[model samples]
Target: MGALALVSAVGLAVDDRILVGVPIWAKPFKFSVSFVAYSLSLAWMLSLLPRGRRAGWWAGTVIAVASAVEMALITLQVVRGTQSHFNRATPFDDTVFQIMGGTVVVLWLGALVVSLLLLRARILDRAMAWTVRLSSLIALAGAAVGFLMVRPTPEQLATDDSPIVGAHGVGVPDGGPSMPVTGWATTGGDLRVAHFFGMHALQLLPLVLLVLAALAARSVRHPRFPLLARLADERVRLRLALTASAVYAAVFVLLTWQALRGQALSAPDGATLAGAGAIVLLGAAATTLSLRTPLP
Candidate 1:
């Protein structure tokens, strides 16, 4: 599951066109990898259920079906062209993808709600249950925001003011003049912010919990006074703290590099770096002060 999620994460973060003659509307390999990963992950989660009716198979089946439908909708959209604007007369294939992709999300939400109810009533104590539930809830919140931002009105593709938001492609020439076909990409939807927050919750939430777990382990490994006689035992907490700090540092640096590539670094990036530096320094100081015994 971790490996699959990691592959999906890479795909979601980077866009690569591996297939030729693919429509621009189609998602690149990155998106496809993430989609496939999510599908497989969901199936694995279902596999964890005990044999027989110990778990609510009905609810699980519904959730699984919804998940599959969601994937299929996305797949269809990538393979088949979808019309951006409904007001404009569109071909049959175009509207089909729109309905499938949009409506399947609603079904997914319904399935999620049912699954959550089942979890709270009968499965909350299970290992990793809370993490799955919290992650799904966070994702659902982001999905809600995205759905609300969508335009219900039919779109006007010909007009400069599009009824549909987030449409990007080539623009036609105005008046009777003929000009070369130029691509014009629009980014007003604020979709990226929501997606960035939502998709990453899987990583962010787990990392948060891992940090907390590390802190707990630190306290257990070293009480008020260190075990001077047993150097290995004495330094366990410090080791755990350092390990966690290193992982945090590496992920932050990767993020910084990404921000640089996009030229999106600014005061916020600087502030984050400063905050991370403070954390590492404080952790180091605490570890050092707790272990200063002249190597007894």
Candidate 2:
């Protein structure tokens, strides 16, 4: 995956070709880097398993294979200077898209298996164990979010010869104005925003635990801020983990809701702000309660 990322980066620099309003190599470059992070995280999570290590490892292998296939097909499309996703311009193009979709399904199933194993296995830390389990399940849901694009949009349905069957954009075309680097639509709802955030819960939730532990360790010798020590407590960490996951899950839902309503992320309406404010307020309340909970 690392090598693929490097190659795609080189392609991005060397190739001036544009497809779907972005640099042709952009998708491959981003997907490769994402796969590198995902593969490494899953491998480490598998190592944390006590009894279900074998099952987790098997699932990890399946995910690795599926990721490789997906990346390969995406890179092939990049080389051909065509869109990899939702492209049904020709029979060959449709077949490529179908195969890519199949790989995604395989990848989701593999993650699901690992998630179930994590639910059954005990890890070194209580917080991280549950974080892994919950994040994995959420990540699976995030992966499923990609399926939303598979359904043909109204415009595509109206057009008799639409080359694409679906799109990432809700009210606008996929190749329209987008944010820098991320390529998210700037004028309309982009489902990729929700999908990206949701799929990364596995990385983000564990990061919350690490940050908490690091802060505790850094303040171990401090006379002030004695509450930092609570982060070292297993019970405290577990409660905080749950709190963070709840807020994270809520935010994911909010983004999905915003996109489905054809709202641009940067221009969220009153409803969007209300949903976000609710998430923040609730998260703050949950955090305070977690801190007040007795730790033994």
- Residue-level lDDT of model 1, residues 1-296, one tens digit each, is 23433544464456443322233333433344544544444444444444434344565565456545544555454444433322223445456546655655754565465446534644432224554455555545544443533333224434565424422111211112211121111212123234435544435544554554555556566665344322334244334334343444444444333332322222235655766577677656655554453322
Q: Give the candidate number with the greatest lDDT.
A: 2
Roughly what TM-score does model 2 have, to 2 decimal places?
A: 0.97
* Model 2 lDDT, residue 101, Cα: 95
Worst 10 residues of 2 by lDDT: 223-232
Tell me the whole-model lDDT of each prediction, alpha carbons only: 0.42, 0.89
Cα RMSD of all models vs. native, in order, equals: 10.6, 1.3
lDDT value, residue 1 of candidate 1 = 27
> How much is 175 displaced in model 1, in angstroms?
22
Clashing pairs in 2: none
lDDT of 2 by residue, 1-296 (tens): 89988998999899999888899989988988888777877787888888877777788989999999999999998888899999999999999999999999999999999988889986878888889888888888888999998989999999998999999999999999999999999999999999999998988988998998887786677737768866767788899999999999999999999999998899999999999999999999989878788556
Q: What TM-score would every model get versus the actual structure?
A: 0.46, 0.97
